[model samples]
Target: MQRRNFLRAAAIGAGVTAFGNTLTRTAMAAPAQNGPGPYGPLQPANANGIQLPAGFTSRVVARSGQQVAGYTWHNAPDGGAVFADGGGWIYVSNSEINPGGGVSALRFDADATITGAYRILANTRLNCAGGAMPWNKWLSCEEIDLGFVYETDPWGAAAVQRPAMGRFKHEAAAADPVRRAIYLTEDVPDGCLYRFLPTTWGDLSSGTLQVIRAGTATSGSFTWGTVPDPDGSPTATRNQVSGAKRFNGGEGLHYANDTAWFTTKGDNRVWQLNLAASTYELAYDDSLVSPGTAPLTGVDNVTGSSSGDLYVAEDGGNMEICVITPNDIVAPFLRVTGQSGSEITGPAFTPAGNRLYFSSQRGTSGSSSGGITYEVTGPFRS
Candidate 1:
């Protein structure tokens, strides 16, 4: 077996031994019950610019261009996921810049301070957003032409970039172990949602790529239209792209409850794909999605909370972490402070869901030290 697969199996086996059942089985057996509402609005941070609720605190986990493992830091750090390995924190972060900053495999002590950071893959182009694997590694994806997905070890070695998944402008990826497949997002005009069915369950290299078909039109015959078109006329025709889309800038991806939730930076919409049923549904249309007094806007990245709620990071507009409750009410769960006018991305929860971590990139109106990571501690009432 490949070292990656072996490590994954061993981790799953250990989890099974500890829990006495499969992770998904336990999750489905007892659905998460809703807790109380969020703990008020976000509290502003001090000089560090980290923000959380009243009871919670924020600290610097790591910074850009910082030296570690004999290599200097890179610029434009983007999507990242947290993994638990024998009681340690393993952070897999991406560098979104061209000749992509490369993936960073960092080990943190119990206090969440960076102990070591090393390059996992080098000389790659535009390593954008990625998701965490169930067996405990990170799926690093390239977002450039003919982009590919690389499955890397938590320790930053033994890497393979799988191109069979697709060759378009790939953005982000989310793995669904229950269905033994993966969902991918493409950043292009009239961009299409895709799924990869692995030939072997839990193995990512061998898979078939398929695009999503939606709208009232039949398959392979749908067209794309601009958002908020003044004409109010809908265009109908297959808007498929041979390689790139004119406007669809696909970005964030997350899988939960057998469905894949994704976001498009161009249109500001959150879509869901029912994997088991092979159907598409609109979870939120940013053009029309209004949560409480705050309408959903400028969504960048998204992740599932332990209570089954989805927390979306807004990269534009108000610069806040918005939570979409089970009832479809969108509100500001955490408003970012310190770095005003900065864009927030990557809102991932720890394995235990006791803490939430997010990153903020430099924006148009503010001067930032590259980016900042924050930890929010609370009940995280979904």
Candidate 2:
């Protein structure tokens, strides 16, 4: 079945409740393993100075500041997710600039090289990060104070800004095929996590926007809280004040196994929201926080692998790709060094999971010395 039709069906089934339901039973079943090279981990190199594991290799897929079909020059590209069309085509999201910039629709060949690039949305601001819809469309979100969610077609033609999802500082988004709802993150102080119930699941034209309350879904109030001490230490109760949840910049959201995984850049932590129970919990503790110990590296953008592994794009300190396995082992899967002030973003795996694509942005020195999309070909052992 087509992804869009599937999502619409799931959304109708999910609306049985107002808050939204977890993915259906069949959708939650274990993912199937198909077509690949080997089961071992390997890394390689590319034109860009990115270093990967033993068997993996890297290449420059696309670069920023380059002139595409509609724009004069490409600005900062952020939060990319992969959409594998049935015809061996890949559509990537280039979160466009703020103050009126649109998302970039990039088409890639089977080898993962850029075939075409064009603008989808225009005259927007802070097009931070977004996820791929099951129907093969891209949902680009604005991260500004009065941001709105925009839906773009795979060819960069059809574009619509959805206001029902709430007008706030938006961040990353993830679509749950089972529930037919899209999970959203707000990149603001005291921002709340939200889920939008589309009046018609696959059709994002209209929906009901609701925030995730801590205690239960029955409560209509949108409450907030900080990451308390896991060991039960005496800490002050932080209220859900306007912009009180400092640094909880809700970024990098993805859904897998009936749960939602997201990153908190401000507090330097990753969390998992169990939709089944309407509860939130930490997926990776402070120990594995970005810029933390070995394995699990720090990151600014993150996505899920085909095998259920979590790939984090390290945006701070060390420029590397970190992978979180189902067993919770955090480790550096790839590293990008030698480039002046270069940081990695948008770590997404192809549908086959054989190739991993990512982008590097201008380093802290304000130089575009190393802005490129890298392809890591290897057996990503989950």
Candidate 3:
């Protein structure tokens, strides 16, 4: 544990102090109907200006334009994922800057020491949220109207463009090997959900891109229709297929347990799609929150844990990362203070589930260059 202690003390110096480790779970301070979430109510904001549950502590991992280990971190850090190496792990983050958007990575050893920092994808525009593939590839997405997905390697390999995934303002992607498909979300106000079925399970060279076909209901039966052109030149992908269901400002996505969960920022709702029954329903809607005003809004990048706890990060609403448990309870697990102008991005858990990594796309100064990445460690439910 000396290494971890060193990480708190000397890893990033004043920017990485840890706190709020000595409190008991007596009572909570959230909605009453569904009770408190897994970690109980959050304590006062710590040195990093974050309010976490008792026994949980946070540290600054990287900051925009600041040296992380040696290399300067990228601005507007967004959509990140962790990949396990032999002994260490790599966390790759995408830059949301318009002209020079790309992907930057932070490498950490087994003891959490910053071994190195580098860029994986370069010269790309508006690189936003992405997903970590089962085969160790990072599917970095773009938020532009005609952006493409870049399959970048976590171990410093060259990046490849995956245009076969379709084009039209992509937000996030989640692969489901059980169904042999990768689900995608669009960022437009009335964007349609999509799926790319590769010719081979592990390869992404060629695939049949399809869109979800359903009624306008939040929960219902659905089907997929193939898109004639993944390129979306003369006709955009969303308008190519008839009856394609529209989501209000689709954002992040994740696949697990034969279900694909995605978020829509415009409506502040997390949607659940059951692959087995072809059914879709709302997992969390701020308007439907019970017994109090919904504690979550500005819903953005979402990631889940082994315990079925879905940690949903906010884009602006109080800058909190709310947890939606399997039992349908939603509560604020942690909140970042003085970040009202910034949004929470890339809420990902490590392979061992011991720590959570994310970033405030714009820090307290309310500028892209002020972005800050953080890691929170505690007794996360396993």
Candidate 4:
């Protein structure tokens, strides 16, 4: 299709939007329950190898081993968060290396150009995925035994590790701003979902770590049990508890719309936990759906759209970004083509919701040594 004609056909209910295509009835519309919105079948990517819906375009902001300013762009850029800085924003990315892995902070201009990049936390192990706090801090998780989550300033500051939050291959965390609670996910096959209730809100130095025990399918009333060892030692933390509920592989977690949305890689399931009602329910389970029906599998890092929908990234195969609508319908939002075998991680949107930032943990060659951070811009619901 010609560029002009393609743009014309892409326009649906909305006026000419900058990015994101409006879903037409023929373009993989959401389940009947989910009303129309600004998402549909992906258009051929104009960029090197990424396909986004019409109006949406992406640019490679940072690539592994690329030197920008003083620091070399970190390899294996895992989970990250975007924070509003002076005029533009600072994107903090994690390095998933074994011995010298840590967090790197990049300063971008208002136009999203890299101004400077530097290492904030160094000498950590397998810094995988983490979340941002309500108080303007990024929690970088170390996916290792007895690994601690480091709270670092996104604008280049020293990091303080919070061991009280529990260990055992931590993946990501979500903060409940209203209740001052932090929800965490473990990355092991028998990982347990944890919640830390700090003595004082926003203070992570001291807290009571507990695990969830669900009574219903995915939603409903749930109970909690204390974790005897927040730090793994003689016995693994998950194994220490007698009946601590286990998620196959708790990979990514995000808190939005008064609920906590998370994914389990082992089972390819996305779950929703109502913070107010204290219940958990399965929102999307790929195993329950026939093969080739769902675009999402190996669900990894996740973020929230302005419309209260959840954007989930695939870790291994497929390499697609899937959206879970408010009514629980899951569909394709974007797919990474040319980047062979690399999984998507760290899907975060700016506060304005106009731009979405994420990283390809393994670069185009699918090697751990290469990775790239990218941003997609268009009309994202706010």
Q: Arrange candidates by lDDT, highest first: which order?
A: 3, 4, 1, 2
TM-score leaderboard ranking: 3, 4, 1, 2
Please report the TM-score between candidate 1 and the true structure: 0.78
Kindly report which residue stretches of model 2 are placed more than 4 angstroms away from their true locations once superposed. Answer: 1-47, 67-73, 111-113, 215-247, 288-298, 339-342, 363-370
TM-score for each candidate, following the candidate numbering: 0.78, 0.76, 0.91, 0.87
Scored by CA lDDT, what does every candidate get?
Answer: 0.60, 0.59, 0.81, 0.75
lDDT, candidate 1, 1-382, per-residue tens:
0000000111222211111012231112111122333566566664455555677666656566556555555555667777775665666667777755567766666666667777887778777788776666677788766667888777766877776666666778877767676777877766666667788866776666655544542111222222221111242111332332232677788776555667878777766555555655456666554333345577778876655466778877677777765545566677666556677865666655566776676533343447555566667552
**TM-score winner:** 3
Please write out the lDDT profile of model 3 over residues 51-122, one tens digit for every residue.
999999999999998998889999999999887766777888999998889899898888888899999998
Q: Write the per-residue lDDT of candidate 2 for residues 132-242, one digit (tens) a residue.
A: 776767778887766778887766667887776666777888887667788888886556677777899788876666555553221222343332321112421122223
Full-model lDDT, candidate 3: 0.81
Cα lDDT of model 4 by residue, 1-382, tens digit? 1000000112111211111122111112212122233477788866558988878889888888988777788889999877777668777889998998899987878887778899999999999999887677888999988888999888776889898998778999877756778889999888889888988987889989988876434445677888887787878888876667778889888765346768899988877766666756666778665344656788999876546566889987678888766554667788888876798987876655688888888878788777988889997654
What is candidate 1's local distance difference test score? 0.60
- Model 3 alpha-carbon miss at residue 14, Å: 35
Q: In angstroms, how far off is 335's CA in candidate 4?
A: 0.9
In model 4, what are the clashing residue pairs, if there are any?
19-55, 19-56, 218-280, 218-281, 218-282, 219-280, 219-281
Instruction: Name the best candidate (by lDDT).
Output: 3
